[model samples]
Target: MLCDNERGVSLGTVGLKVLTSKDAKKVYAGIVAAGLRAKETVLETAEKVQASASDVLAEAQEINEARNEEIFEENK
Candidate 1:
């Protein structure tokens, strides 16, 4: 019996079990699917963070080089 529960494993009666071996397999599958989706989200977030850091580093390097060039010109 299907119930309006998130896990789909709701007991119909006081002595009834909703989960059998097959039901366990489906639950496992759902867990695996959720894990994969979470992993994908983590990977995507990491990529965005890495890219932002790279851009910031590049900008800092450019600013440092400009400062160095100005210092050399002053020394000359």
Candidate 2:
């Protein structure tokens, strides 16, 4: 959409049309709503990934602690 050559019309021409069109306001509103929805989806996915990473780290720490205790007992 940012690139202007495919439609045989320049970006300036399209911008002008969108600005003056009767339903321009509605079109812009829809664009804004779609963008907000996308942003929300991205944030939710990022939170899930962070939670999974934290869980894996906790499991790793437990394994390491168990290994250390085994080594200490073997030495004694």
Candidate 3:
């Protein structure tokens, strides 16, 4: 038998349980905590990627400048 309660659904005698208010609060807290942790992880990865990209751009600029100097010298 399946029914809807004010809080959640009830499935009778199949070992399924409904969330009481307290249990619901705990579940909500857990979900929030997980979301925070995931956000932190994503932010950390983004920072690392940004730093790496900056380094690559700097290196590429240096190489281009060196090549420009070589061409200028050859034309002299």
Off by over 4 Å in 3: 1-20
Candidate 1 at 46: error in angstroms?
0.5
Task: Give the alpha carbon lDDT tens digit for every residue of 1-76 in model 3.
Answer: 4346623533443234445566777998999999999999999999999999999999999999999999999999
Highest TM-score among the candidates is held by which one? Answer: 3
**In each prediction, how many residue pairs overlap at the backbone (N, C-alpha, C within less than 3 A)?**
0, 0, 0
**Candidate 3 vs. true structure, TM-score:** 0.74
Best candidate, lDDT-wise? 2
- Model 3 worst lDDT run, 10 consecutive residues: 6-15
Write candidate 2's Cα lDDT for 1-76 as tens digits: 5454656567668888889787998888899999999999999999999999999999999999999999999999
lDDT of each: 0.83, 0.91, 0.82
Q: What digit string (tens of lDDT, one per residue) describes model 1 on residues 23-62?
A: 7779989999999999999999999999999999999999
Better of 1 and 2 by TM-score: 1
Runs off by more than 4 Å, candidate 1:
1-20
Q: Would you list the clashing residue pairs of candidate 3?
A: none
List TM-score per model, in order.
0.72, 0.71, 0.74
After the best TM-score superposition of candidate 1, give how far the Cα of residue 47 lies from its true spot, in angstroms. Answer: 0.4
What TM-score does candidate 1 reach? 0.72
